[model samples]
Target chain A: MDVLRPSPSGVVAAEITIAEPMVRLRGVSKVYRSLRRNGTDVEALRPLDLNIARGEFVTIVGPSGCGKSTLLSLIAGLSPYTTGEIDIGGRPVAGPYTDLGIVFQKDLLLSWRTILDNVLIQAEVRGLDRRKAAARAAELLALVGLSGFEQFLPHELSGGMRQRVAICRALLHNPPLLLMDEPFAALDAITRDQLTLDFQRFWQRDRRTVVFITHNLVEAVFLGDRVIVMTPRPGGIAEILDIDLARPRNLAVRDTPDFARYTRRIHDLFIETGIIKAE
Target chain B: MSTRTRNHADAGHPGAIEGKPAGGLDKGEAPPMRRTRRRGAGRGFRRFYSVIATIVVLLIWEGGVRLFAVPALILPAPSVVFATLWERRDLYIAFSVPTTIEIVIGFFVAAVAGILLGILVSFSSFARSTFYPMLISSQLIPKVAIAPVFVIWFGTGLESKVFIAFLIAFFPIMISTMVGLQAIETDMVKLFKSMGASSTTTFIKLRLPAALPNIFAGMKIGMTLAVVGAIVAEFVAADRGLGYYLLYANGQLDSPGVFGAIMLLTVIGVILYYLVEWSQHLFMPSALIRAADLTQATM
Candidate 1:
């Protein structure tokens, strides 16, 4: 087990055992050229330099059209970057890497497949041991409080429950890195809070490098070890603030003075960057 | 539990004494869950009225024929049509068997070919650009105009009718398969790709299952067209089959025989259509099947 070192901000830090850099982006950038509608070039992401240590939970928060999702896609190797380099564990990302797992905004679970089969998709695609993966799938479903829903289809579950299933699928492969793009944005507040706490508990239990993108600052503060606040067009990092609060965090942690200070700092940055107007 | 039982146990209430105890209804009365006895009876009555309406029209035709003394060669009475159908039942059965075989074989061939081509076109821009336009444009030409050509090419046998049926039914299945395969949510494709899913795995696990409902819809349309194609080919050139028999009856001015053949052809088409519907229920996912059933119920 890696030993936990206190974060530099120093508020009784959780056991954040940062080891070697898991993700490295050296001046990476992306420019999307639209070919279908109008032949126009849109600079979705400016060149960025970011280093995420192994087992770090980083949340990216930005205004809409800030290309926060583009950043994730570039890292996941789902799409090619226009320039610069991205390496995971010192190896350059050439294409979709086997070491990464992704959760999208929607559950994207196959309606025809049962919950168990949907979770097993990762194993099927990766050519993993079917029996072992199925066992893990069951355990993960139980972890996410979805133990009894293995045979149900996607349409049968509520939105929050479906999102939990998607989360289970993302973790079933036990990838070193997990990329989530606003996975809980569509749920109601109560469900969102419940999932957030559940997520925090899981991350605490078994650490993995996570890059979670959200528009909600509260979520960013609640879940991330560091919140990377971003600017609007040609999205670039505006601020990177370390969330110094201790974990395992619950819904009650949000009411603390430290949590408020972190949220306020990000809120102020958003205003200064013209992402939101001060009222 | 005691409070609920006390209400039920009251002896003075006639509601408790009646056999139809719950909701205090009279004996033999319809329950609240039912569709209403009046409405159920009304639907049955409407169906009975439809049959009665058809009989009345037949009676009027029979009466008009006798009263005006219309030529028997020109128009046959209902009785004459029934009598002719009964007398030549063996002939109709014999010819219908071959036509039915042709339609079934043709439809199966079209389904297999259409789905394969659909998968090919969806995966490659080269295939899509090359075949999509040709498939769409083929529909514009009159199928009947090519029926005789099919006879010349494949000869005046089962091959000709099968070829004609396949041609007519092929387009709908092809177009529908293409549409179905492409109808997936973009995120779904991205999801599979991100998981390092191979093209084959993505196709078999994701694209194919998602396309089933749309493919089934197209197949239903193609099935009806297959029946039409077979009959049309039979009309142009066939030694036997219902269409050929109908043409033979017409030549001899056997109006009742013509009607009988036409009625049998209609019956075959109806049976084939219902078969397609039944298969859709069998193959499609339960969620989609339930959705379709709900839509049908509401409509």
Candidate 2:
């Protein structure tokens, strides 16, 4: 249990000394009060501490009941935490932490807006310079191979393409932190793999500190610098495994023994936690 | 295939009518291609069929009245109705102008007030609690019953008629707008917050555009109701307008005159409804197209 606890010391010693971690969660927890008068309160996440360094990608994996999403929400400051403190870029998060990008399972693009306009919404809302933001939006869309689709509406695009547009929307502002909640979960196997590959390239170009949540064990291992495996209900970190694989890994790396070993370890943890039953 | 065998096969099949091959060779075409072609042709065919069906009904009525020797007072022929409409065009047009004005003014006022109230109710819990139930109860009270009260209060002037129309038209708009504003996904709201959007920014950019489809739907319903409301108000008390004209014609036992006024009323109602629809198309073409696509997919 002591070894599983996430510590700043476990990260690359050189990077830690350079600057403070991008995100710091100290004994953060969430408890949702029941809407009904007599209904029981739900302890969605147990108190836990974590440190995410700059440019590092940390992926959280858990079963449906686990509060992995709750943790992400806490960091994003989209919801109020029940207890403990969360710091992003050394500032205490009071309301929504605006200097970050977030992507949910659904693309959530406005149906009326064109692809270019959709990506530019982050800029529009944030009050960034439109000309610069539009240029950045074009570049980001091109990065995700969505250059020609700028004029099309969201409904015209396929699900995967729309997700790609969403990614571009998220990245348009060039936020230091990117939080994704199962962004690829809705796509088909082939589309998911392609996105995973493209995502690596996107991450490599400008490595933002990312806290991604996913249910897929392989995706967790493949994407994370450190994979945070969470327990079901009152979700706390079960273990955080350092993904020792090289950067910019392709789909073929998923087939390698090293990747398999990491995924296998997470799978074994899920079974031990009774999230899965081999029998 | 034999009729008996075909009938036996189609007994439980939902698509039996549509799936039936028009000619023997139609079965050889790919099912998907055949279905697409049929859908494309079906739209034009349906429109043509509707026109033909309306003509047939009119023809039957005209022929039946002549054949059965029915009295003109009882049921005027289509020809007589149209002829009457043409003969008294000036009177009908004069009456219709006031009716049209009442509808237009009432509808516009209702739209503005309903939308504003919807926004208030959606944003403020206090407003929601206090006004939502009252709004529902107000809807329950028959507008017709209270219409005379409006006439008493505002008098038999245009105000009373406009007020009545405004009353009838606003409920659906307010309710639908409220529902539309509240229907946004929680995650989408969170995303907006994360972007550091102010509440006003969120309302204008996110909530307003998202709610347009529902708002337009409400407006369409309200437009038709507005026409009804104006006429009802005029029925209660009016010196002018189509409703007063209709009553005047009925009192004189001038059946053609009554029918002509009614024909004018129908024209006004249909034109107002289409005006609302056209505005929706202009404002949100993509939403309209998407709605069409969704209906197509379901079909």
Most TM-score-accurate candidate: 2
The global C-alpha lDDT for each of the candidates, from Candidate 1 onward, is 0.81, 0.83
Specify the poorest-scoring 10-residue window by lDDT in model 1 chain B: B1-10
Q: List candidate 1 stretches off by more than 4 Å.
A: A1-19, A34-40, B1-84, B250-255, B281-283, B292-299
lDDT accuracy of residue A165 in candidate 2: 86
Q: Which residue runs does candidate 2 get wrong by more than 4 Å?
A: A1-14, A17-19, A34-39, B1-56, B286-299
What are the per-model DockQ values?
0.20, 0.21
Question: Using Cα atoms with residue i matched to residue i, what is each candidate's TM-score against the true structure?
Answer: 0.83, 0.88
Interface RMSD of candidate number 1: 16.1
Best by lDDT: 2
Angstrom error at residue B240, model 2: 1.9
Stretch of 10 with least lDDT, candidate 2 chain B = B1-10
Of the true interface contacts, the fraction found in model 1 is 0.43
State in Å the error of residue A19, model 2: 4.7
Worst 10 residues of 2 chain A by lDDT: A1-10
Per-residue lDDT tens digits for candidate 1, residues A76-123, read 888899999999998999997767788888999877667888899889
Candidate 2 at residue A92, lDDT?
99
TM-score values for chain B across all models:
0.74, 0.81
Residue B89 of model 1, lDDT score: 86
For model 1, how does the per-residue alpha-carbon lDDT over B43-69 read when each residue is reduced to its tens digit? Answer: 667868866997899899999998898
